[model samples]
Target: MTERGEGSNAALSKYEGYENWKSNIPVMYDWFTNHNLVWPSFSCRFYLQGTDGFVPHTLMITNCDVVKPRVKNAEDISQFNEEEQSPFVQRYKTLIHPGEVNRIRELPQKSTIVATHNNSSNVLLWDLEAQPNRHPVNGAPASRPDLILTGHGNDVEFALAMCPTEPFVLSGGRDNSLVLWSIQDHITSLGSTKGSPKLGPRGVFEGHDAIVEDVQFCPSSAQEFCSVGDDYRLILWDARSGNAPVVKVEKAHDADIHCVDWNAQNENLILTGSADKTVHLLDRRKMFVGGVVLPIHKFEGHKDHIFYEPQWCPDRASVFASAGEDGILNIWDHLKVVGNNNENARAKTRSAPSGLFFRHAGHRYRIVDFHWNPVEPWTLASISHDVDKTGCGVSAVIMLGTTMKMQEQKHGRHLPVYAFDMLRQIWRMSDLLYKPEEDVEEEVEAELIQYN
Candidate 1:
């Protein structure tokens, strides 16, 4: 993909922020690592494996530069001859995928068991542990799928999820149907197959009018799940009640809904991101009232189209993260926005949107995907499609921490409040918000003066 702001006034201002972020990394993060990918990937997920040996912690990614080259114009060409490159990522293992991976989701019960979707009707499952490590290069032979899921009449590119409660897999496709599968019996024999094995869905639900963009299983149930589609509809499904939708919100957003994620801590809450540039928080219990479903809170923090699913922080009940074409990953505290009546606090932070406490501006391009590290507290792994000088994409793992101290305790210190304006200003002045060249320069200068 071509980098934004190239040959424009915003180009310098954008890289200035990146430099500032790199300089402040030591203070802003407890730990940080950036690995350059040989090819860009639209999806990234932290593996279930621990960090005891050869690999720090296994990470799953895809390579698709052969399919869609990232070097598109002179601007990208200029970056091809840098003297040095970012740290290289060690390949724990590689799966020669059948096609470019449009999206990826792992079985929560078995992280080694991964399901990948492409521009086809089938969902390919891989037992990463059993798959032989192969070097992926141009025209490499495609690896056979350990298990293949069939039922979708069209391509199931992006909408895919795995159940947290059971060995169930959920997928949505262009066919406008939600397909469910169980890998319970196939788990033990996952890697035993030398040829392509196939599995069919236990049930198929039809409701969406357009291609399904995202699907999420209710954290607490195997039979309960939800889906959002290009039709601007959000449908909740229950296998116990047959193929029909249990609850369908016809107009979930003003634009196409791209993603939907159900909260694990609070079963009552669900998050949906749309092209409308908003994340709507829906309460399942209060979904249907007077024959209409309404969102409990509308998060208007994103400034561009929301492309990826908004993910909930596994450890925190009210915290979550959302990213999109805006090239920003915003961390929000729902409790801070929902029913918030503190006019004083609102006035002090009026420059930013309500509930937005932290913003990640590390990526120079749009953030395509991100996953919260369940094993690490407040840690995140994010990937962007921006190509570097070495013809590689950026993958970063960051542990979130605030330099702003909350309080001083007897034994140690507290640094809980991360959204303070002082810290936020560092990124905001560095091109997080678009402004005229003169204004941006003046604001950045003033910020430097204040710090000096």
Candidate 2:
């Protein structure tokens, strides 16, 4: 056991499971908040909840000085706590992004119009209310994109997607192809200054063999979509039929599939996330049944990391949320992990895997991305790759709330202000998993300080 003593006993058992999930965030949260970032934002979004009430829900972040690779030590970083590394964001508004956002998407019919991915193969749209907040220093100057999404020939960063039924834009990269676009006449030049403009491609779709890593759309199709790759295949596109693959699904996920979602209320469901740290659940009408292609319900909960993202829950359709690299964020319910054949519900989910009720280990590191606040309903906005001490690497935007009084006493009355009644009040006030550790922080910062 000397691989630095087995990585210091797995960083002291992931810092004693993040100090028992931070002392059970006040009986598992009725609220939570943490917003800090100087650079490090693979993506975080939630905009659209404004009636001009000054700053009414707007958070589309990115300022990436890249840097990721620190693995902890220094006595596992002096057992953490400096106000958890400061930056509870009291005010923020900046977007000078032109590169290194790696992935950012918003535009379900224009939520401040965005779309970025800058390792590059073109896809930088933005118009956060007409950009121009600057000051991301160190030489500044990258902020000029109101439109420029040319077809990918290579480098596509993280398989983007945007189209809840037109105003389309779908991508997938490293030239493994699947490029579509419609930007509906440039959606009024995406907030206008009208200078970037590049467009192109309304259909490319070749069919992955490697490197697509996530894409989704078919939440009631703007002509169908779905992708996942590094060649563990998932395919399923359809610009009203052409391009290719109306449904592929080979191998589906033994490994590699890094993120995919499409089930805005079950368009025949689909959700993948891999590198094999599981989360399957595919349907698309029985992904092949008799001829073998399966994945009706897998989700083994980040057993050893690698499952980057898997969202669903635009308003809970059997709930969903998953983020990983082992800095957890799970919240499942695929009808209690697929059709209950009730063996006392399979021995109460075999001690934790039966639709993974709720678990969000408050990021000590590696949460990469999260967003499920299609206008606040149990709100969420997570991001992390936490690295501090000036070598920079931070991006956190947590804000969660829960208060499940046994789901309002088993639906005897109220329970619909969003997100599965705060994840059924962190699964019956932390027994589905934890307990003890109070201080709801002024009641989750006065009910999530208007989402900063």
In order, the Cα lDDT scores of the candidates are 0.65, 0.59
lDDT per residue as tens, model 2, 27-134: 555445443343344444421111122221223332211011122222332233424322122223555454444556667665557676766789878766677665
Count clashing pairs, candidate 2. Answer: 2
Candidate 1 per-residue lDDT, tens place, 207-319, comes to 99998889999888999999999888999999999999998898889888888999888998999998888999999888767877678878887667777889998767888
The best candidate by TM-score is 1
lDDT of 1 at 106: 63
RMSD of 1: 11.8
Q: Which stretches of candidate 1 lie over 4 Å from their true place?
A: 1-16, 46-89, 137-139, 288-292, 343-349, 387-452
CA displacement after TM-score superposition, residue 88 of candidate 2 (Å): 13
